[model samples]
Target: MQRPAYLHASYRYGFWWLALVALGLLALGLGLRDPWPADEPRFALNSLEMLKTGHFWLPHRGGELYPDKPPIFMWATAASIAITGSVRLGFLLPSLIAALGTLALVTDLTNRLYGRRIALLSGIALLSTVQFALQAKTAQIDMLVTLWITLGAYGLMRHALLGPARGWWYLGCAAMGLGIITKGVGFLPLLMLPAWALLAWRGKATPLRLKELGLGLALILGVAALWVVPMALITTFGDEPGMAAYRDNILFKQTGKRLATAWHHVKPWHYYIVSVLPWAWLPLVLGLPWVVPSWWHRLRRLDARVLLPLSGTLLVVVFFSLSPGKRGVYMLPTSPLLVLAMAPLLPGLLCKRGLHWLATGLLALLGAIFLVAGVLGAAGLPALTELAAKYDVTPWVWWMLLGVAAAGLLVWLRPRRGMLGLAAWLAVFWALWSTFGYQQLDQTRSPRDMMQRVVQITGPSAWLAQPDFDEEFLLQAQQPSVHFGFHTDQDAQFLRAFDWLTQAPGERWMLIPQRKEDQIACADLSQVNDLGLQNNEHWWLIPGTAFASCQGDASAAPLFVAPTTVADAATAGYQPATQQDQDGVTATPEDSGK
Candidate 1:
């Protein structure tokens, strides 16, 4: 009972091109829509400042030195700001463009190497990958970084396998360099495919001409230097040594020492292995036996092209496995490499009637998961929505996701339609992110808004101290001039001694705010204030003597007394400080300012 041989070759290729285009659009939409965590907005704001000030060096966030990472992500956003006149969208565009571009590249390259049906399945798999799609819209540089890395690896592999082509070499050089600029260091992992291609084949190394190699290398270095040299010059002279420290620690430490620098970047070795399940899902587990069987057969026969992609994927996975610090994104570039490696065989796995049931089952599981995403969105986001009322559109996005998941379940249940089921599910999942989730980003206040709130609370004369960093993060919202901690709030020298006292000589107003568990910094504000309220993560405002008069009783007796920097003249103009104001906390200025 042999099935017709035509089934393998007869996959409808014409619509897959359209599918790729749809995926690209979906990716772009996803990227543009989700602002996600504060980190992404912070990147966007920094880049916006770079564009506005025309100064690429100093990232004056919240009106101070913003020292962290090379400004590659910022530089990227500057281009978007120029075109769109909106920093928000500009910040997200790189990831969106990178994601969609990667899809097109995968479809085009894999189709050329494998077949139309393979191209379709690979494109759907990579693009629809639940986590991957979500990450594309995030503000982080990882998505674009992965795109360049994938391209670089693919290009280098092509040159190695097909003999040295001038274009392939040049593209390899350029893509690798862009990959470096995106995240700094670790570019070698991205080149794993090409390296594996060379290593898997036992013959003499295919040599590139010194002239061409040098030329390509120069182009790569030139593009990288465009961003790096400026950062070096500025950090050498900036008030903050943070950027300089990062440069020395990350670029110089190369791999190990810097892993200890930040918690967000820190994790156990098995972190990636634990995370691979969500990214690869059930299909990877099901396809494992088939993958190795083919691999063992091909390797015994010494097939360079077949070995190249597999080796590349393995190299990256094994390399990241050894890193002390492993975030989910560390293996991002590996996604395309692995997808491309398995592309030729994966479709056959999907096409099989018995084996294909696993794919359907996986789709059903995803449907159940997304159905939960819908419920959580409707249930969980209201608290965030109540606090962040501007995100009115966010709740609908969740419901829409649920609806799409329901639709996907219908598509997935049909007979022999795994490919189409993948597309429908991805569409609904991403569609929720693009139109509904993206709208929530606008609810946040920029540095400008934050500064205004601080000003409205404290008078012009009060010193606005930052107990943590330079307070650059808050300033990136594009607010007017708010003095640095030294000028507006308590200077560093007085922050420790009797900070919560009603009045301290040079201290104008205490703005020390408390923080959450996952905050980047830690401070014991016990000496500063018993202020019952908190901010971003830590540090409470120290109440000065003057606040008591301001907080007496709001209804004519006096609203509430507020702590002040100087006991002499009380600041005026706003309603008296009270324990129960619009923000819903029951801490009057007197309660925590001590």
Candidate 2:
């Protein structure tokens, strides 16, 4: 069958329209809310502290060296915050830019490998995936790392499959190096080499040259040294107590040991295969039945385009699966390559009636679920009512879900355009979730309001210490705060906090989460003031008097790192706690218990 001229022209221009739509979808609610928990606030706090302390090389969180991850993502975030002068506005910029960059790279690579039509479809497919959109809107390292990995793959594929272009290969190596600095998994794109070698063996691709390979390896090393050499030099010679540990931790435990002898987030090896991909990949995964067969057929024909990306993605999945530790976001870097491999088959597969119905049915099913949940929630059903009370969400959230349900079902009801309707429904879901949903859930998900209440209860002059605190609390704290350490043992943190509180009984206070109240051996939980629920945890504000009966741990000295700059307090609309007030205040033992 021949395609018409108008359809051809539409295919040529479709990606631009998709790009604009993606920009709006990914960037709709930029500055409307504070960073939420789990990872966002941690990264945002790292970026803010970087700007405050002017420590660009080694990132810190709550005034302690953060050694879990490299600082490239934080560096980008700090640069964004520096330029915008607002964490709310700048924190998510890196992910947004990286997401857009990934889309552009995928589109261009697919265009070169396939054609304009496949390229457009690939972009649309990548944009439509749940994980891609979610990561794009998040202030996390995964999205930025994915961009670098995609760029690496793009460069490698271009030179290996399309040409003997040395520049592109070197560019790819450099990108992989940058990815390594951004996240430990950035070297993932190099997995494509085995597939490239297979292509070369099949006489379908150029053989690797030793000199070029050595130079490319050198490029990767050189780019990584940009951060590595300086960090090593400073930490090795620096008088800072923890610098050596930070050096060793970031270089070893956080990388190889963390991977091989994984301590956290452990799941069975089939976790991704069984649990994550089916949902995380979304509309793309829905087509895998057809995609898999087509891919096999292409592989049989020794098509380098299909073989390279497919093998790279499989190798990445296998690479992570071998590790005891697994997170779904660890698979993010594989998405662009997966989509590229799927691009050539997508046009025909998308047109299949079964796939269309499946996509539309999924959309309809989601709409029904939302509609039912909203209706039940509005009717004060016990499950929904308990959920609302637990999360402190309002009735309007239910109403908003109803709206999303209505919008999605309406699109699904459209005739013979199931794929288009599915796309529309996804667009509505993300747009609403980012803007309306963000505003509605911000109070509960974020610690901003909770911190405000703390400040109100304790007064502006009070010096606060959070023991075993989440980053969101510290980021949103309106008072100048001290923390024992982020990774310190909970009981040890409380012991240190108790000692610190006794130093200035009248002026000092401790904030503790209910989950960790067991660690407060010295404090009377009854005397602790409840600060209601925030971020799914009950926080207590304990006046120094609450710990007055504590046995002294005078020898237990904790690292008392105060914010280098309390400008964030000003930004939060409170005066920074004065050092004089914190240090000069002294109360007699009798007055302390008052």
Candidate 3:
């Protein structure tokens, strides 16, 4: 078979070019987009809070203890922010480094295990995997945890391949310890046990002295102790409620409690098998059937290198699957192992006539589907409209159709490297989507613009308060005008806010939930604007209160008409039809106090 154009590019210009392209694509939109709600903003806020408080040992959010995760990610993000001073750039670097570093590690490992061709292929495959790419760009702890797990796994593999004299065991354990502090399941690298056992059963064991193994265990504990011991000592001795919650949640609820009975993300045993691996592993999933059988044939020989990846992959999958609390990102550590398992088979598979046909056909089908949907969606077909509406499908999505069309054309024109071409095409598609399309979507979902509108209406001299506001609003706004009050069961919270609004000597603006409008209505505060956030949540803003005159005319229509952003049309979440302000209030010209 003739070498494919992409492979030829790799052979001639060197595959580092491909790696650079992949990393560059991953880094494309890092500085442009605002922090997304739910996870992104929360993580970013925690890091920012850490930076503000100068309390590096414990992570807090909005003046409260945050124990859902350890402080490693926050520490890293805070350090990045301290140095770079750009929230987007700072919060993004850790994940980017982890992702590119993982790719480099995979390349190095594969090159050692197989050869240059397979190493390049493995790096490309792992980099372009849908979940891996998405997680790398996200400001979450998953990618950081993945990095530590990958390092730990590589260290163990080195020991297995070379010998105990190398101390790869200790290095691997230390990485796993770092992973644990980064995320709770850092010890997942220990899944190598089953892999080592498989090899031993096949008489391929690399015997290690008991002392060395003990030392590795100690290293893991020692790394964990650097944080755990300090946190425990301080929180145990201190009477601070937040610190206590942090200790309890981090040590138990986030780990043991989650394992025993997770409150969120509860899924059935087959969740990973059904929902995660199939999609998360994507192009690799398509190749697994061929790869698995080939590995199975070699199982009896139990080459340490082959057994290491196969067993580690199976163990991680099964372990996460058994947990009732499962998320796709939890299994990120398996990406490299899957890449390793598939590398030996890739050369032959790349040259296979049948695989080439499969690649071309799949790409063509996907392209045709995208083309039809894009045309229909553009043509205002109700079915597609409803579907597009359900996903906040942006006008920019037409670009994806172009991408799909290009991918299809490339594969058809160069069938010899259809798989590689398709992977490269998808990577470019994702990069472009994240770079441009993401901002378009974010403009609607994120409250950054909405808050800016609030600041505009209220002006800099005015004082603004959001009682029990989400961190996204605060972080994105970044204005001293904003004041936060803790949400609680007490009615005094509302009374205090109303009293403040009614008695404040100057203009006092507040963002309140629409549902609570009745509670503060007696204050006679006039509604200025509103914002619709994710999950059917809506907030209303009252301009200022000094006059006892109550704009109690509750029937006023919305003064500000929210343009139908693409998100409003696409999201399944309820979009209020009234000419509502972004804060979810209907304002009339009469009520605008003009």
Candidate 4:
């Protein structure tokens, strides 16, 4: 089959237009600051190895195969490294591109299916979304995974509904498979593809056979196997011992690891519900009564466009709800769906009284919240102080405060504006503070900063320790010529592996943030040379005598902040239960438009 000229031409040049725009915005969001983490620094180091060593299959750094995620981000980043010779820039640029790809996908797909106005708004909303904004630029694979999933969803739907372009269907399958490899099991969105195709084809019996779909799946699986099979085989040769452990981490444990549930980050299913409220505010929050009204109108007139978004909203929330663990940002992928489901139908959704309320009353409500929070922040400092004792006032809380004020201003300026007002306000709020303010509030910067700092002080052989991926700063700072934390040791990841926390500090070395603050086995802070500082937080964190000889436990004072006592982690809004390996119970999801 000779490919048609128009389709190829339209996409070849046109796709880049969208991609370029997405790329530009991505760069804007990430700016010049280093990556932030729980996950990003490790991702950065993984790619750095792919660059430094020129090995694609086995991701090793300092000396170990890294495991938190598969190699898609690393491969993408590594490719960048080959061209630019800069590891951080290489890894970051691709993820930024991928993240932008998502917005482009959202805009074009929705625009083709719906209209340009709705498509534009949805894309902007997705890009501007609080969580999406942060994740897309942070050099983590989750955004890439999200990009793959979203693109796959768009491709899958277009193939199933618009018409069967076998190529498009195959691409959908391929994208999904990559998505699976990118983050494990997220490829399951493919399961819904056929049913959607059926629905799109108006229930027509057709030649879109399971067998052909099987081939497409095979193609995706094959690409994945190329990477997996080699890594698996080479791992047995002692090239990648962690591969076996990672296989378990990826395949069974992440989903099934419940034996004593080594981690304690689990939270109640209501976690997202409570978390989203602050971002959503009274208009959306108190607008709960309106969900029935919105659902009722859609039901009255079976609108496919409205239903599509509603379906996405349901699937995203329901899928996560069923998961054993929860993070607020997990629901971020479906943010565009929320706007699509509700905002478009506003004119139709409002009955006489409802219209009046959506116009006048909602503004009034937001006004009240803005005034109240400000009054509370200024006047009720005592209550806030007490609350702060329980929960360190996280950056998100302040962001929410700023968002509420911005939302109020938007509403006051234009009550009938709908989501445009919401988007504008949120954008203003984040732009103002994300660079300077949020950075401070966030305790963990990506290990890039930490990595760079360590490089300045110590050469390759300085012994170091890392309790977790906290060494992101160190890696970002420079390539290791010698052994150090995050790469040197990952055993500190297990809460029980406290022994791994012990390390010898060299005269010139300091521990990466991930390393335990305790004394290194043979080194003393008293014996160390000062290396000046790392960006902001590292300035205050002076190295000390080895953990074995510390006057007080390091946890009492972390390398950066005045560390809290053991009683603090739980009482101070950090949920130990939130990290539980056990799955959270599923709750009945609230109706979509609501």
Candidate 5:
């Protein structure tokens, strides 16, 4: 079974080209845009708050403890921001670095197990997959956690299949501990142990002693304690109001309860297998027809290399699937191992004409769709124009789309090299989207424009309060603003906001979501200024005068939590709304245009 000369050449030099393409695609959009929700802004803000308040152990969002997950990712983001001095640059660095790290580990491990050609193909497969590329470009915890898990798997695999390499096993355990701190699911690599145990039972692999397992467990706990123990102590004994709740919620609720009785993002057990794999694992999914058969053959011969990663991947899928809650990203930890399992077969499968044509057809279809959409958008097609209007982006975005489409089509012309062409098309698509697309959509995706307008209407001297505010809104606020609470009910938030508004009528304003406008019984709606739509929600600005028509309840005192810099608050002469200003105006006309 002699590999072709061209294949060997590719194996020798393919890694560098893969690295270059990855760097260009993933890092191209760094610092060009603000973090877009539903997760990016929240994490970015967490990091920013960490840097601002010097509270790295307990993450906060809008001045309140954010216990939904541990602070490892935030710590990484904060460190990046501290070094780079730019949130936009710092926020995405961890994910980008993690992605590269994952790639290197997958490639190197695959090389050791299957040789260089399979390794190169493995890296290419990972980079070209929709899930991997999407998560790499996203500033989410999933990708960073994925890196840690992959490192753990790499070390464990090295020890299990390659040797009784104690050092590598310990490294894997430590990495998994780090992963746990990054996200709760970091211990996922431990699932690989079952396959290893199966091999041991069959007299095919080295058995880990009870002492070795205990020590590995110790290492994992020891690594996680680097953050957890300190956090637990602080939150337990600290004078902070919500520290106890934060500790319990994070330690128990977010981990075990979140997994078992999961409240949100619920889906059927087959969600990942059906909805996710079809598209998210693209190009890789296309190769499964060949990979499954090869894997089965290898398994029948009791090949430990094939058994370890394949079993681990399936175990992870089943682990997440059994849970009532699911998200496409939750299945991310399985990708690296899955790709490794498929790597050995990719060399043979890729040479098949059917696979080549499939690759070519996919690229062509994608290219044609984008090219036609771009042309129509540029010509002011109603549907495209409406979409642009909805996002509040200029038609220039379509021109950029046209350029990307043209570039992709150019690559697709080489039908013989369809897989390579497909990879090339993806690189072009990511690079353009990261740069031009990021800039074009930043204004609409972010709350910068809306917050700037809020500051303008309220004046520099006026303090602002936002009730039921989102993370992006608070992140972008120029004024020294206060939020009621992130999880507070809308009615309670409005009541407290009304009470706060009456305290300093002329010097303070309230920003409320338009959807919740009906909840403000104390405020005069006619005097509520419209702040227009931002982040797909209309916002209304309420002057102090808007609340003068009703009497405030003494019980509804404001719970002002300020997330903005204290120095900025001081510079703006912003005081807590509890400090009433006697000499304040009672009425002012609503000026929506302002």
Candidate 6:
């Protein structure tokens, strides 16, 4: 069958229009929100610290050496912050540009292989996929890593097919090297393995000479060495012993430990196949089940298009599964190939009766979900209060129902436009969610409001000590807080830090979480003000005048007697009120939104 005329002719040019839509989707909420935790504030704070300390190679979190990641992504983020002068805007640019560049590369690659129409569609598929868009707007390294991996894949494809000989190999290997620095396992040659296997099967692997392969490997090592060499020199020979942790983490823990015995984000072996990929690459995977037979047939015949993506995707899934440390986003580098694998089946899917029914059912299901959410949000139901408490989303979030209804109508009236309609529908929801939902989400996630109250009460230069400190709160407050200790471990470091807090030059204000107030043995303490719940954790501002438990300071000087118990502590302007609405537990006066 001849390809559609529109696929060949219309898409031959003006494909960049799709890139604009992607940019808009990615940039919608880039600067409107403060960095939230779990990843954002960690990286953002690290970058901001780097900017302040002029230590570009070493990454720090809350003044402690943080070495879970390489510095290239943070360097880019720091540069962005430097240029933009806003942390929110600064940290988001690298991912946004990487996503846009990936889309451009995908379009070009698809155009070469499957014609311009499929190329454009693949780009659109990538843009609207929930995980891709979500990661692109985040301050994380996944999107940047994916960008390098995609470029490397493109280079490998060029070498296998229409390459200018050795340059393609060098280009691909160099890109992968950059990926390695961006993320620890960016060196996974998922693209190269499949491309090589297919070429070897067809007796066309001679284009990749052994001499060129060695050179490419050398280039990759050299590019990666740019940072690793300097970093190794500093950490090995520097005065800071804490940097040994950083060096060990970067060289071993970040990659090897994560693969073998991950300290965090561990999951079952089948997590990727059973949980992650099915939804992470959605819209592309929407009709995938119905098209698998066609893919299977193509694969059985050794079709390069199907084989390339199949082998690459299989290798990545297996490699990640072998590692106990699994995250959904870890599969992001293979997402472009997943999109590519599905792009060729679009025409078949458009005609498949099963797909038509499945798509319509999905559209109806989406409409129903939005309809219920809108009804609940508009009616101001109690059930939505929990969601609202967490997301801080407004009644305006339900406005997406209107867009959903419009999309349903479009699908009903013009069934042939179902795919485009579905893409538009998802795009509209994501945009609305990002724009309106993010506004409230930001307010709730941000500590700027609560930190401002602290500043107002204590003054800017007041000696502030947070034993169980939150980096996000500290970053947002822009306060160089005195770190007493961490909640997780109470080692000698904690004792020394606690002693420092107790014996500091002047009186200190301890910002203790209300739950931990009973744990501190401090005297002459008084309540200042309640800084409302952040991430559902309630904190109280307690001013400590005397250290009750200093190791050797029982008879040093006469300041005040330390309290023996929580009952002995004094409270000023303290009123405890329990409101059972925000969090599942009984909310304290802190729930007053103070």
- The positional error of residue 339 in candidate 5, measured at the CA in angstroms, is 1.2
- Which ranges of candidate 4 are over 4 A from the true structure? 1-26, 29-31, 81-91, 191-208, 237-243, 254-264, 274-309, 336-412, 438-469, 476-594
Clashes of each: 43, 0, 14, 41, 0, 0
After superposition on all C-alphas, the RMSD of every candidate to the true structure, in Å, is 10.5, 6.5, 8.8, 12.8, 7.1, 8.6
Which is superior by TM-score, 1 or 4? 1
Per-residue lDDT of 324-416 in model 6, one digit per residue for the tens? Answer: 888998898878877777777766665655554565566666777777777676777778767676655575345656546645666564554
Q: Which rank order by TM-score, best down to worst?
A: 2, 5, 6, 3, 1, 4
Residue pairs with backbone overlap in model 2 = none
Winning model by lDDT: 2
lDDT of 5 by residue, 1-594 (tens): 443334556456788888997887788777667778999888877877776678888999878889898998998987876675455567889999999999999999998988887888888889888888999889999999999999999888888878788899899999999999999888898998888998988877777667888999999999999989999999989998789999999999999898898999999999989998788878777777777888889999878887888988999999989999899898787789888888778878767666666877887777677777777787888988898888888645555564566455556455656766677677777777776787678878987767767778888678888888787777767677887778776667777777777888989888878888567775788988898877888889888878886565535534756665322322323211110111232111111110
Q: What is the TM-score of each candidate against the true structure?
A: 0.70, 0.92, 0.84, 0.67, 0.91, 0.86
Q: What is candidate 3's lDDT per residue for 454-531, written digit by digit as tens?
A: 667777456666666666665655234433233343244454455555556367777777777666656554444656
72-170 in candidate 4: lDDT tens per residue? 877886676455433323446776677677777777777676665446545655665666766665677777777777767666656654666677777
Work out how many backbone clashes candidate 3 has: 14
Clashes of 2: 0
Which residue runs does candidate 2 get wrong by more than 4 Å?
Answer: 1-9, 395-415, 564-594
Put down candidate 2 lDDT per residue, 231-339, tens digits, no spaces: 9999999987689999999989999999999999999999999988887888888888888988888889999988988999899999999999999988888788889
The CA lDDT at 179 in model 5 is: 94
Provide the lowest-lDDT 10-residue window in model 5: 585-594
* Strongest candidate by TM-score: 2
Candidate rank order under lDDT: 2, 5, 3, 6, 1, 4
